[model samples]
Target: MGKTTRDRLLQTLASAFELPEDVVLDLTRITITGNTQFLMENHRGILAYDPEKISLRTDQGETVITGRNLKIDSLFASEIMITGSINGIQFIRSRG
Candidate 1:
């Protein structure tokens, strides 16, 4: 019903079931290779995109990618593949 409640529930269930935090919380997953490729799974949607930056929404919160010549090589409902000279990645969690 609320952030504290939900978080407590997740923690309780996770500990009781011996489940990973991500699996128990239903969070997004990210994969990166070198500095040229990026992939995200369980993404909600894209928030912003440009040659130098891209922002995406996820179940956990928002993710921002910054770099040069960034391009979305492939996109799916729940997954995205990006290619470029990735300079940085940031994850922003929503405040309760």
Candidate 2:
């Protein structure tokens, strides 16, 4: 099937389920706690990781996080928890 067809199906499912499109589409969800911790769900994978930087691929784009003493405190198939002195977070749109 084509991308648009799949997208429309997801949208319909979202409406039927009364859920956000991102949730239905398995898009990345991010939550930050102060400058110390970050939680992300529905991520594809970690592209890069280090004490100062971390990058992840998501359905919407690439997510880049910069920080100090960064570490993946917890990791699972659909979720990741990072702890550090976060400096910045950026989302780069995926190129078509």
Candidate 3:
């Protein structure tokens, strides 16, 4: 089946189960804590990384995080955690 059809089915299932689309569809979830820590789930991969900037690809868009002394504390297949003096977060919406 096509992606659209699969997504539609997942949407319906999410609605019927009263579950968030993020849970059912494996959407990206980002959380920030105290401007010092960042966590993301279901992330595709890191596009770029540096001490001052980090970019990641997700299902919805590109996530760009800027900060000072940025460090990746943990990384997994679909989750990542970064810690530093976070200054900004930007989202570039996906065309597809």
Candidate 4:
């Protein structure tokens, strides 16, 4: 298949799995709507990296996470590592 076709196919698959395009392309970081944050390293998805204050938004409510020094390690493609204390996590969905 062509590069464009292949890219589209990969994007479709990634979206279906709630993954971002950067993750598939082995990018550095993938931020969705500035709400959902994803750190890419290898080929895995690690959620809740922030420890001091991690927030996530959904259509219903939000999640707050609290801990300590929040950080992501070995982030390359779809793999990420979170360190420090998990302060809180929040989830909020945007209405359009």
Candidate 5:
């Protein structure tokens, strides 16, 4: 099956079950707590990391986190936590 077809099936299931699309598709979920911390779910891995910038790979594409004094506080199989002065968050979806 192709990505498009798989995506369509997921969408249909999500609708039928009234479930969140992110959970169904294993998509990235990000939560920011003020400018002091960041939390992400379903991240593939870290693409790049530094004090000022962090890039993460995800099912949908890429997630870029920009901040100051960024540091990964905790890492799990599909989750992450960062402590820093977060300034911005950007997403770049890959062409499928």
Candidate 6:
């Protein structure tokens, strides 16, 4: 049988790390509500920060979320959620 799209993607990603099939890959998902919002996903994880309120950096890149009373309420082990009135969102990739 052929591999599913998800399985193929996973396999391709796994090849980069020389990881075995059993090696679980970490994934991050971000969601925002209100006026402004931002979402970023990378091999490292998800990062949600307010450009007007805070500055951030990552091996993957930078993501800026701007809005009124923009608040990053939760940043769990693998996901991030932002809330409040927002104006703009930007994503920047710095490296591999």
Best by lDDT: 3
C-alpha-based local distance difference test score of model 4:
0.47
**For candidate 3, lDDT tens digit of each residue in 1-96?**
498799999999999999998989988888899999999999999999999999999987899999999999999999999999999999999887
| Predicted candidate 4 versus true structure: per-residue lDDT over 21-60, tens digit per residue | 6658443342322323433233333334345665433222
List ranges where model 4 is wrong by over 4 Å.
Answer: 1-51, 54-65
Clashes of each: 0, 0, 0, 34, 0, 2
Which pairs, if any, clash in model 2? none
At residue 4, give the lDDT of candidate 4: 57
Error of 6 at 78 (Å): 1.8
* Per-model root-mean-square deviation over C-alphas: 1.7, 2.0, 1.7, 10.4, 1.3, 8.5
Error of 1 at 71 (Å): 1.0
Candidate 1 off by > 4 Å = 1-4
Superposed model 3: Cα runs more than 4 Å off: none
**Number of clashing residue pairs, candidate 6:** 2
Q: How high is each candidate's TM-score?
A: 0.85, 0.85, 0.87, 0.31, 0.92, 0.46
Question: How big is the positional error of residue 46 in model 1, measured in Å on the Cα after superposition?
Answer: 0.4
Best by TM-score: 5
Task: Report clash pairs, candidate 6.
Answer: 35-86, 36-86
Give the 10-residue window scoring lowest on summed lDDT in candidate 5: 23-32
- Candidate 6 lDDT over 1-96, as tens digits, reads 243566678878798778864443433334554465544333244344443543334433565666677665656543355666767666677654
Candidate 3, run of 10 with poorest lDDT: 1-10
Per-candidate Cα lDDT values, in order, are: 0.91, 0.90, 0.94, 0.47, 0.91, 0.53
**Candidate 3 structure, TM-score to reference:** 0.87
